[model samples]
Target: MRPTGVQPIPLASALGRIGLAGSGIRADLPLVSGITLDSRSVQHGDVYAALQGGTRHGADFAAAAVRSGAVAILTDEAGAELYAQAPAAAGSDVPVVVVPDPRRAVGPLAGVIFGTTDRDGAAPALFGVTGTNGKTTTTYFLDALLEALGRSTGLIGTIEIRAGREAIPSALTTPESPQVHSLLALMHERGIDAASMEVSSHALEFGRVDGVRFEVAGFTNLTQDHLDLHGTMEDYFAAKATLFTPERCRRAVVLVDDPWGRRLAAAAEVPVLRLRTEPADEGDDVADWTVADVEPSGLGHSFALVGVSGERLVLRCGLPGGFNVSNAALATIMVLASGVRLDELQHALDRHDPFTTEVPGRMQLVGEEPASIVDFAHNPDALERTLASVRRPGGRVISVFGATGQRDESKRAVMGAVGARLSDILIVTDDDPHDEDDAVIRRAVRQGAEAAVQEEELACEVLEIFPRGAAIDRAVARATPADTVIVAGRGHEVWQEVRGVDVPLDDRVELRAALTRYGFSVLSAPRIES
Candidate 1:
């Protein structure tokens, strides 16, 4: 989505700004108005970034991009060769700007081409949140808090991208660099004062956020997830740490509850404000802000942010669980790091109650009688926290979840064990097989649950059900009025991929219908269907 009213720059000038002017073997250059990575989305006067994929070269579609009115082709040496051989390059005068690493170059190119570069203060003040979990909720909290402070804000995260009231569904947690700059430019055009974004490890590693400086970067806790991409936890942590550099962000607010957060605070290249949501030892270095005097409110917690300098601010969140407290704390501290005064923020909180904003599919409530919930807690740590949080003193916790195919297979067993240990009834089901055999994925998860029940002599009942809709129905059918039925894994996702095909499956809709069918009263929020 390119912003309107930006003056176009010469293709040669855009390449020169990114240090690729003389290093290119190219043809006639034209004025470049926009940039895109996908050939299908190319517009008139756009530079088509032909990158190499895992199995296919993007240059294979060079002809299509040219036909769609691409003024230039941005590619690497290999991509240049492929484009030269492409049929569209035989007599085409389109310029081919070659770079050593096109992935990293796309950011600078897009920034320069779209007039969103650092030469002018054009982009909004960006707040970035990164971690294994809590990223989505924290971004939502950031947006809400910014709005409460009287700033028109934009949001870019797992669920959607927003510019004021308009929203478009998100395809990635962090989009490709071209689209990122384009969105930032669009937000600036629409007069959005601030923005909050979720920066994933994949985004950092793949240079998706290159050349975009955040006003204040935030660090949530790191856990064991996405090992398939990083290959190790250390690598994953390093990737997230890159976002805190002085070149990337002006300042940082880190949650020091875990060793990872503490390490990040000590290692960040920018000024840091250490925040702790849980208790710390007496000898430990005092955090810049600590969450204190926590008490349960309606479906949430009211807490005070006590600063090291005798500053105390009261804040409350409508989201449940101890983790949400951490999330809310992180959002508040990041806003303060961006220079919001205590009294100003308190006034907003008192009037708007922004932290209590509902983050869809994080810990979403669907019903009341049986206490139905739908969440995206696929990883082991998230599963454990969610299962423990949803438990009632006298009622049972019934969970229906499964592992996603081709993503950190080692966590499947761990998640299964966590579910079995914490839940009274664990029902294993399919979660987006994505070209892998569904039965094989289910077997591994079920085996882990069965093993936990046998080794620990747990009183939990384990069941394996396929075709998740039936599993959801079975979970509701077996639950009593006191039991809490949690449908975990695919939260807010409307499609379930099986053998490369997307099938319609929204957990909220499924849970709502099942709860209504079983005589349980569901929430009257019409946004659930939307």
Candidate 2:
């Protein structure tokens, strides 16, 4: 559903001096009620922005967008020239506006056409969470906690965008400027007083979150991933730092367990709430909020949240792992620092229990007998953490994972090495090999794993299997009742991309099927049959 809070601006009025030729063009130019770049999502009264892409030009799909009821077209000079030369439909003349840089104009034009001025008039409180990992989980926790505190909250992240019972599947980790404002407006109309969103580094760098005004910004420790896009670790970190600028957020909640987080806290202009799991060594003096005596059990964690004011708030988070305890403590401090009543703190944290249960694909366990975990741990840091989390006292750790095609090939070997050192048995498989040869990708990861074992002399067996379903089946069949099988990469994703085509595949489903085939009771499986 489109957000109604922003008044739709007339196409003619919004486009000041942009010339329109024929009367047909004027009549065709309906009010720009919405803006979208994708032809598939174009609706009546929407403007389609056509930009040149790497593989295909958006101008090629202009006809499709018009047919799908896009009222006007915004394109670069090349796209406008092409659209002008192309044949017009029988009774339609699509008005095309030729901007110098369609991408740059698309965002601001969306802001103007959508009437999203940043005038502060009691707008909903916005929270942004960013880092290499745990953004989705932390956002979910904040959303649930806020809602439980009698505040209607909207959530936008990797999994979904939810306001009340209405949910929209997310296309981007953070939506473009127009969609961001539009979603916020929808939440406002739904009586949502607050919103929590996952702000990705790419989204921040690309101006996808330009117009967002956040009250609280959060940091979940940074680690290696997305080096292919950013070109360097420094570049990746710079993008994340943009969210903590004074213009974007008023306060920051930083988890200083990682070196990057500590550095960011030191650099932030906004007041920071620092959370730590380990004992303070040399840096405890600078922390504003510190978590101490962290104890992680099967169900949750117990820790002490000590404020800089010397006030102690004991927090028992119903989220597994010590990492999650830091996440919860950071989130709790962020909300409390945002002016939440001290009396409401415990109740809000109590509500975090239910929130932790719904984090999709985050260490999600499946199967009854052998038991498997599906996590989005594609990088070395996350892989090591996942292995450490599920390490049973006397059980073996079987890991199934693969590197993505055409992205940070440098990390492939590192991931392999970490997997080899952590898991007793490692099964290398396919993970969104998008247009690249799957074997080549698997071999790169295998090389890393082999290097790790040879260099460190770790006693681990690494095996490569093609056709991801077969790999999952083999791993599940081989796992004993006491062993834990972790299926990493492509967590919660239903489609597997190969040669640009997305095929239907889900790891959890295949694992359950494999366990059932092996005579295991399916009653205790974590995933429900679809």
Candidate 3:
């Protein structure tokens, strides 16, 4: 939903500012109060963006949008033609602003309509973190860090959007450009000084974050995923690199652990502070910030952030896994690059334990007896890291996971291979098989596990289970006190899509109930609101 306190702008002035004007209408006729791409979400005085889609043109629903109170139409040449032929346009005089590319124009239109683009010290300092795995966790950590520094913060990510303490559940990692701007405006209205946002490659490629420039953009790492949308690794990396451009952000804090991060550090258009969260090779260039002296602390680890000039800040993460260290280090460096003094950050770190903030679904703990956990490790790299981190000294790792249907089919087998290599028992199950056959999806995953087991002669037990709830039950029931049960792929996701229907499924709830039924002691309910 859009904010309520927006100042309406005349349609002619808004169009002229963006260099686009409507046809067959008076300049002073319509006043623009808000902008939205969805015809169903149209409000009075809103500009309905009717762009062409893959299969159907959005203009097909212009009648609905107009009825819902859209005063103007924004579309491409093709959409304009279709809207003109629509029955709703038979005698209608609604202005149609046709552009060469309407998707790109939506961001600027929303920006002008929402007053977010030309902020006069009102917009929150936007911190954008982009990567395959750590975006959510890093953004959460950033929000906590900013709050510890006595700044009011907001968050926009896969889990939800927050303005002060109010939260709205999110459907995308980074929402459409209009919502992105509107949320920032809402945060400004609430006196939030800063906001941490998860910027996915899809958001960059689809123009979801076009009109916003970040104070500091962070890169976690690049890995194979979303090949269904982007066909190659280079294309995926290219989409992420767009966030580091001068038009998108002022400065960048890039993690140079993987080759992709190193490449981004060398190629970012904005000034960059290179951070190394992992060990560096002898020939690698010296990083601006490095993580050192990492030691196990409770469920997580404590580490030192050593700057190139010998400045250091020690911090601890309450989250499990070594990868969390990378996530925390990225958040710390991003805050430091934003001008927070080292001593101040260290004080905040010590006083508030900001790095130990609980991220809802990233390595979320549900039980301690069998060490049951849930994570959003749908990709190959994330699955490998998660599996390795959950393995105990004498405990067997029993993993239950599945690949998402119709998305990056190439990662399915690789994820399966990784799971088999790391987990002692891998159970292939169903994730969101949106419109694809569930059995077919499970077969691909199972085949990969079988192939890996046979080729490597690994002593791993591979099983196939259907209906994700039953899979979680089986994994937990089979586990002993010494085993670690991990349910991955669909963490924090509360529904599963089969064909066109959304079935209710929450991994944490299911895991918690199963653990209780198995007589295992589960952790208290997660305190962080989703």
Query: How well does each candidate superpose onto the true structure, as a TM-score?
Result: 0.98, 0.90, 0.97
Q: What is the lDDT of residue 486 in candidate 1?
A: 95
Candidate with more favorable, higher TM-score: 1 or 2: 1
> Per-residue lDDT tens digits of candidate 2, residues 1-530?
56765566677655552233333335335677888888888888889988887787798888899999998888887887777666764356667876666676666566556555452543468889999878877887788778778888888888888876788778788987768766766776677788889999988877777756689999998898998889888999988998998878888888888789988998998888777766667745567777877776455777788777887777776644556776677778778878997768876665545346557677766753565777878788888887877776678999999999988888899899999998999999999999899999999999999998998999999999979999988898788888888899877787889997989888778877887888765534445322
lDDT of 2 at 129: 93
Q: Return whichever of 2 and 3 wins on lDDT.
A: 3
TM-score, structure 1 vs. true: 0.98
Taking the tens digit of each residue's C-alpha lDDT, what string does model 1 give over 1-530?
66997788888877788787775444358888998889999999899999999799898887899999998888888988998987668998887877889889898888887767772469889999999999999999999999999999999999999988999889999999999899899988998889999999999999999888899999999999999999999999999999999878999999998889999999999999999998997767789999999999987899999999989999999987889999999999999999998899999989999988878788988887788888999899899889988887689999999999988899988888999999899999999999889999999999999999999999999999979999999999999998999999989898999998999889998898888888888886434332
lDDT against the true structure, per candidate, is 0.90, 0.78, 0.89
Name the regions of candidate 3 deviating beyond 4 angstroms.
Answer: 21-26, 525-530
Winner on TM-score between 2 and 3 is 3
Candidate 3 residue pairs that clash? none
- Model 1 spans with C-alpha error above 4 angstroms: 25-28, 281-283, 525-530
